[model samples]
Target: MVTIAIIGRPNVGKSTLFNRLVGKRLALVDDRPGVTRDRRSGEASLMDLEFEIIDTAGLEITGAETLEGRMRAQTEIAIAAADCVLFMVDVKVGLTPQDLDFAELCRRTAAKVILVANKAEARGAESGVLDAYSLGLGEPIGISAEHGMGMAELRDALVEALGEEAFADPLAEDEPEWWEEEAPELVAEGDEGEEAEAPPYDDTKPLRIAIVGRPNAGKSTLINRFLGEDRMLTGPEAGITRDSISVEWDWRGRKIRMFDTAGLRRKARIQEKLEKLSVADALRAIKYAEIVVIVFDVTIPFERQDMSIVDLIVREGRAPVIAFNKWDLIEDRQPVLAELREKTERLLPQARGVKAVTVSGETGEGIDRLMKAIVETHEVWNRRISTAKLNQWLSRTIGHHPPPAVAGRRVNIKYMTQVKSRPPTFMISTSRPEALGTSYTRYLINGLRESFGLFGVPIRLGLRKTDNPFAPKRKRPS
Candidate 1:
């Protein structure tokens, strides 16, 4: 599909237009300028026209060394890659000198350009729309990106620029693909096995992974290394990333969709509404992701906030792999890594045996190992043990370390069976479930992790009282 990119000076309602086109609030939008520093892409449709739309950082006129300048560079790159550019102008703000400057730059691009006069709903915006003609980019199409006005006209403009053929409908294809036709059959067959605990994972589906950490943990840098492209904006800046940007990539022929999220600071420190929104976006990414990679600054590894994030990931039931970033900065590697691993087990006992990879997102070190660990952790997260094996393990484990009696009554765990996989939930029928102590439950969880290789993932264990059918009927009397 043809890719169209939206470019304009800061706070020209670029993100609003992007969200309107994409039909989702994928990009971060605020009253402030430069809320968007990195370019975000999504599939968009205008009427019958289905195409890819890119939302880029506002173009700024600043020196190359500054943050605004870096944002400008990203916008330029977006313009270069796009098949068409939507050069947006704030008719409400009436086209600033910066808008004129960027218009010249857009005019020089090889891509097709369409001038968009935004905030056309406001009174006296027509003069600004008329003034946009002096930029020499042709008639400015009036649009209200915020109120959803002039979309039909905008669609007409896109059709005229790219032609109806460029907006090919994906549903036009007659034949159903192999995955659509046969993948469900494969899943059903695997699930029908006598000893099958969980259906085989569909490799054709992309793995959704979210990278999260405290501010300046190099989450974006690590993702850029994985993609082998500067897809994320990175710098010495602590909170450079604002939106949880999801990028599609392939590693070793495995499809991966990675979310680069904003740095999560403590709640007390987050004063601005924008930061709150960023944090919420990051959290949503974590909730939806199958695997979460918690990137840590090696120098400040296992900080309080880092542990909190890990606990959150655990509570979210996401498979986690700890990534110690900036390993190149560490002088003594072996002893440090060993100590870190020990600390990990102690501090994060809730997620015991979780995988930790030493990586340098800057110099591209240990990335291969990181990717391998991610895939392995995902498998472990989706692992299931058959009823026979689970019972056998439980019997052996109980024999070695039986549960202590509560109130002189023995609490007997009769049977256990895995109910589901993704994060591995199990149900146990017990004689006195309420009498089971937390320590004994922990012991059982640890045993399950050790016995079935269910490491690096959250395990859900539930207890239900075993009903005695022979002698447990109570008479209902008045």
Candidate 2:
């Protein structure tokens, strides 16, 4: 697919156009300049054209050491990689010196530049749109990115710039069609006569992983290391990342879609509306991600906010892997590692046996191990136990430590079956479900975790009263 990069000065509606093209609010948008720091991409469709659209940081002229300069470097990189560039300018504000400087940049760098005069719906924007021709980038496409105007003309311009052949689906010729492939056969039973588990997870499917933690926990730093580039805007500053930027890349031939979310701060500390929105985006990432890497600063590991994030992940039923980031910063490795292990088990008992990896985001240490752990944890999260195996285990467990009697009447555990996997959930029928205490449930859950190797991932256990066949059914009033 053709790759198009949107570039311009800050607050020129570059992100707005990106969100419009992607048909979703993937990038963070605000009236404030330079809200977007990192370059984000999404699959976009405009009429018949299908392409990959990149949302870049607003171009600014600054020194290489400055944050704005780093952002500009990313945009320049995007411009180089892109087949076409959409040079957006706020027509309402008219073309400024900054716009002119970037226009010269687009002409010099991008192969095909499309001048997009945004906010065209506003009054007096027509004169500003007309003034855009001074940059010498051909007739400007005047459209309101916020109002979704002039998309058809923009599509035409794109087709004209990059031949229509560029829009053709590359997969048609390069890869086998998904629908043409043979369907997988379902197995009813296993070799030992146990119930058949769900088919193995599709390796071809991209694994969705989200990196989350409190502010300045090295979430973005870790992801940058993974990509082997400064893909995310990272620094010593806390909360530099405000949007849940997702990047799709192959890790050891396995497709991985990793989301770098904003650092989550306590509610009282998040006084600004923008911060609130950023936190909300992070929470959304946690819910959608199949596996979540809760990053921790090695120096201040497992703070109150960190534990709260862990609790949130468990409650959301996401498979979690703990990453002790900034390991290079630690002076004594052995003692810190041992202490972290002890604290992990004691403080995060809910997610008992959670996999923890010590890593340095700055030096790219332990990344391979972390990725391997994530994959393994995902397998465990999606693991399903056969009904026969569950029943056998239940029987032995009950025999060893039966449920305590409720009102002198023993609560009988009847049957157990796995309803689903993906954070494996089970339904248990009992003679007195209400009478069964939380302690017994916890015991059963722990047993399941240990027995099935469901460490770290959340396991759901629900109780239902057994239906008595001998009991007469209530007659319907007809």
- lDDT of candidate 1 over 92-111, digit per residue (tens): 88978898888889878747
lDDT (Cα, tens digit) per residue for candidate 2, span 1-478: 7999999999999999999999999888888998988899988999999899999998888898788888888899999999999999998988889998988898888899999999999988889988999999999999889999999989999998999999997565656533222332332322324566557766565688999998898898899899988789887778788889988788878778889999998888989888888999999898878899999999998889999999899999899999999999898789888999999999998889899999999899999999989988988987878788999999999999999997799999988888777778888889999999999999999999888788888999999898899999999999
Model 2 stretches astray by more than 4 angstroms: 170-194, 197-205, 475-478
Off by over 4 Å in 1: 170-205, 470-478
State the lDDT at 179 in candidate 1: 20
lDDT of 2: 0.88
C-alpha RMSD (angstroms) for model 1: 3.8
Provide the clashing-pair count of each candidate structure.
0, 0
lDDT values, one for every candidate: 0.88, 0.88
In terms of lDDT, the poorest run of 10 residues in model 1 is 178-187
- Measured by TM-score, the strongest candidate is 2
Cα RMSD to the true fold for all candidates? 3.8, 3.5
Error of 1 at 320 (Å): 0.8
